[model samples]
Target: MARQGRKPKGRPVSGWVILDKPKGMGSTEAVAKIKWLYFAQKAGHAGTLDPLASGMLPIALGDATKTVPYVMDGRKVYRFTVRWGAETTTDDTEGPVTRASDERPAREAVEALLADYTGEIEQVPPQFSAIKIEGERAYDLARAGETVEIASRLVQVHRLDIVDVPDGETTVFEAECGKGTYVRSIARDMGRDLGCFGHIVDLRRIAVGAFDEEDLVTLDELEDAAQEGREPLDEAAIAAGAKARVTDFRPLDDYILDPATALCDLYEVTLSDDQAGRVRSGNPVLLRGRDAPAFCDEAFATGQGRLVAIGSIEEGSFHPKRVFGGRH
Candidate 1:
């Protein structure tokens, strides 16, 4: 069924991929690679991880992209290493040395500084960050040798624990924090508090929201699977060089989480077939008793064991906020 000489486009893939991104690869690049491998129609990521850092980067394909906002607002956990004695222009190893110090804080001194960062506190983001300054990225401005004065904003650090002090040169630690918390800022601030300039040398994200390390799939594993002919195309697609119909790529089910899992933390409301249809049509449905869970604001409606729509509650009624068509 070829129409003229138009090139073949892949099929629609709808799911979430919790990628264990390798170090030195940017988050955007990881998303692009996964999108290409899957030949997905649409894709996006929940958060941005620096090229110098690695670990859990959730890629949303097709319908799953709708739930990205909720995942981005979720808490995150990171384990990072801070190298003392010098501060870098980017607050990490990627940037050049901007300041140096012979001073090194004692283990006790570092421990005391953790408390200062915990809870809600005002902290300035690193100058070499993606934050916008007058519509231009702060990093771009800083890179151009322009003075970038980023204002301090309040961020929450739920837990800050020192995992190990590998000699007197570096400190390994873990941080559990809410949205917008930057690991590099923590390292930068800690250095200033200790009077010894410091910068993050290693960083890895372990968890984001409900997705954790256990859910991650390495890019190499996926590539290896493809090489093994795990993704078999249908006869017609193969003839057309389409490979587009290879939706049933073997082993992908193991790596790809159900699109519904993206909204697992939210409340669930299973609706009748008629109600589900109405919700899909962007109509509001009145929920009663068990269907209406107390203190539930955000929820997803399911019908026939498939995700129908994501909605919010108001006046004991569930309103279809983001309607999802087709299986997620």
Candidate 2:
């Protein structure tokens, strides 16, 4: 039998698919569906999104998967609603109630407490979380009826604001945070401090790194595209066209973002034939040209707008760390 998942099969399609994940779909499930729909040889998601949450899950295909870490390290923004009366075992609606309260906090009180949650704060993740404890998943242990001591770690909450309070039962909040910040932890802790136990009733991730809500494509859209025969062009074809300077060819599906799209956050250095050749060969070269980006610790090089490598600039020289072989 062929080694499973060792060699990916199908088209070598490479790009980012910004999925508007539905509330019931897990991140892995979404990635699997995308892989099937696109017939991609390789696929992976930038970050994990809980089944209870929805929106903007970035899935990288083929060579795009090489840039997954960059997207994973980027900031995340979410809008979530917290039920004001109880805290759950999982910190969200899927779990049973662990604590309850009758006192609902006022809007003014919630607003006043927002500042305290902003900036860097220590947070303890919920028991039903992915954190590892002695090489075992915390969630796995919790599910097995084991109690584990989870440590609190600092997470950056760039901004946290109350979006609305539709009723005394729930309060909506929009939070912009760095990687590792948990929206569920925010709701759980806030409730305890406010003396009104709470849990995440609804959650949606609106943005991650270079992607945002506007870039999302629903599963229904993917199904429609598949049915209509709309799909990303083959990577081999794209490579051949690039060599022939054929920039006119466009993918049948316009929704597939370029692999370079993930590097939009980095400084860009357009390379000449010689410079690009050196970068592609895993060699460093002195960067030149009026369009060369300013000195930066990290940047990406492109030839004719196609990604060559992600590198660093030091003493006007670009050193390739991760080469893309000039793939489109």
lDDT for each of the candidates?
0.85, 0.86
What is the alpha-carbon lDDT of model 2 when measured against the actual structure?
0.86
Q: How well does model 1 score by local distance difference test?
A: 0.85
Any runs in candidate 2 off by more than 4 Å, and if so which?
Answer: 1-8, 230-252, 290-295, 326-328
lDDT of 2 by residue, 1-328 (tens): 8866666466777889999999999899999988877777789999999998999899998889999999999999999999998999999998889899889999998898899899999999889888999999998999999988999999999999988889989999999999889889999999999999899999999999989888999988777666556435578977777322212223324668878888878998888988889888999988777766546898988888788889899878899998885132
Index of the highest-lDDT prediction: 2
Model 2's TM-score against the true structure: 0.89
Model 1 Cα lDDT, one tens digit per residue, 204-260: 999998798889889888887656644566898788776433344665545677677
